[model samples]
Target: MDWDKLRIFHAVADAGSLTHAGDTLNLSQSAVSRQIRGLEESLNATLFHRHARGLILTEQGELLFDATRSMAQRLDAAEARIRDSKEEVFGELRVTTTTGFGSLWLAPRLNKLYEKFPDLRIDLMLEERVLDLPMREADVAIRLKEPSQADLIRKRLMGVNMRLYASKDYLDARGRPEKIEDLSHHRLICQNVNSTQVSAGSTYTQELLTYNIPSLLTVNNYFGVLQATLNGLGIGVLPDYILADFPDIERVLPPSESREIPVFLAYPEELRHSKRIAAFRDFVTEEIFEHRKNLHESGDT
Candidate 1:
């Protein structure tokens, strides 16, 4: 019930050691231990099971920890709202997206954003796992599919398709396939069919594999696939959005491609008024527009 005690308990539970929690809270280990004891006495519950290794949460501890975690997230959200100045776009903005898109596309274009808001701090999280926006796990997300979470604002950023590509040197060495059936003679590089990815990409890879290709190199992510293709290893199944930045790579069997995968940018409804969120949203939207423009001018379609 006491805010300070709850805070201390959360820290101790998180660190799993009184000494470590003391270090974080700027208190002596004895003081932290005293607070924990007091909290347990107040609630008549054993919060942690002491052991040689460290402290493990008891059943009651787990429940209290969950509540404390929720409180911490809400406090963080409130602090973020307070720090978001109406006229200035500065402070940390956490963005999450797939490794392929984040590395190949968004990361490269971030320089322009920095030039505009030199004081802005961005934490870019690249992975296949979808972070929870409403819980403040991340401030914004660019996902391969629509977010089903409630009380969030979503926007469709763009559409992408999985297509075959290889570096000029690789295509020249192995020869390019004129049709889908000709893939039988070439080594195929792609994401592992079982790896976590958009259904469109996985289904496309499966279809390509059905060609009975003799040689194959599978990586769990597209960055690896791109690297292998760049090194003249094999033709790779990759997203079409990569063409804007990597013009040197040639599309193989242009007629063959995957179904369209929708790309969406989303943030919690609570972040609607945050200037940091607004700046980031506009920056990404503008970059996508420019990306589309570049692709059109180059006749890459």
Candidate 2:
């Protein structure tokens, strides 16, 4: 088995498309196809069941892929160890977090991290679905709740509460709600009760829904809800961390809030010594400290 051919085959199989694999490998489609053919001939087996959509691995290909996948993971582990031996934080760091925090909080503050580690590349994956950290789906994760995944080194970064907020202009026009019952006459914006989110947030949203709000705007993510609130659409339920970025948004019915949701930073236990992880973890920790300090000094706490 030729290592180069196997590598190309692995890329093609992983992507499920020749063009995508070619793009990643920096090779032409013809070249990738030729390598796959050569690999098939060398092994005397039809590796892929080709169709109009894409290729599917055959029984033999599945067996070969299992071996190649193990080889690739081992290689990645060896590379991570090699990189950890160096002090420089220069490599791709895949970080995952909720769309709300990643977009509204972490992404804006990443420039400071970049300023320190000028050569670092961050791949920010914003989604609600938890990635498999132990499987290398993401290098690090900042989540609204403590990760339940085992074999992870997790730190509780902070706690955030979901609260009602609206644009100052909107509140000035509609008048602020003095109590939860008063909210029935105003437009309430929040994540859909069915959306994948922290249980605390979802529970709070469900409770608000029972108030018979005159108008409702439900978004799947807080980012959308925030945008709508900023537009003066309605009072939105959002995390407290956003106050640092959106000063114009005023908290409404200050006493109305969800149970505090803990923010956590976690990484695979195997990456305990990784310099990249350490750099990212330290940078995020510093940002949170600064955020807290700013809120205190501004009298916004």
RMSD of each: 0.9, 2.3
Tens digit per residue, CA lDDT, model 1, 13-115: 9999999999999999999999999999999999999999999999999999999999999999999999984589998999999999999999999999999
Candidate 1's error at 137, in angstroms?
Answer: 0.6
**Clashes by residue pair, model 2:** none
TM-score of each: 0.98, 0.91
Model 2 C-alpha lDDT per residue in residues 1-301, reported as the tens digit of each score: 6999999999999999999999999999999999999999998999999999999999999999999888887787678878888978898899999999999999999999999999999999999999988878888999988899999999999999998999999989989888898989889899888889999999998898888897988998888999999999989999988987898998888778899999999998989999999999999999999999987887767
Give the range of the ten consecutive residues with the poorest summed lDDT in model 1: 82-91
Please identify model 2 stretches exceeding 4 Å from their true place.
15-44, 298-300
What is candidate 2's local distance difference test score?
0.92
List where candidate 1 sits over 4 angstroms from the true fold: none
| Per-candidate local distance difference test | 0.93, 0.92
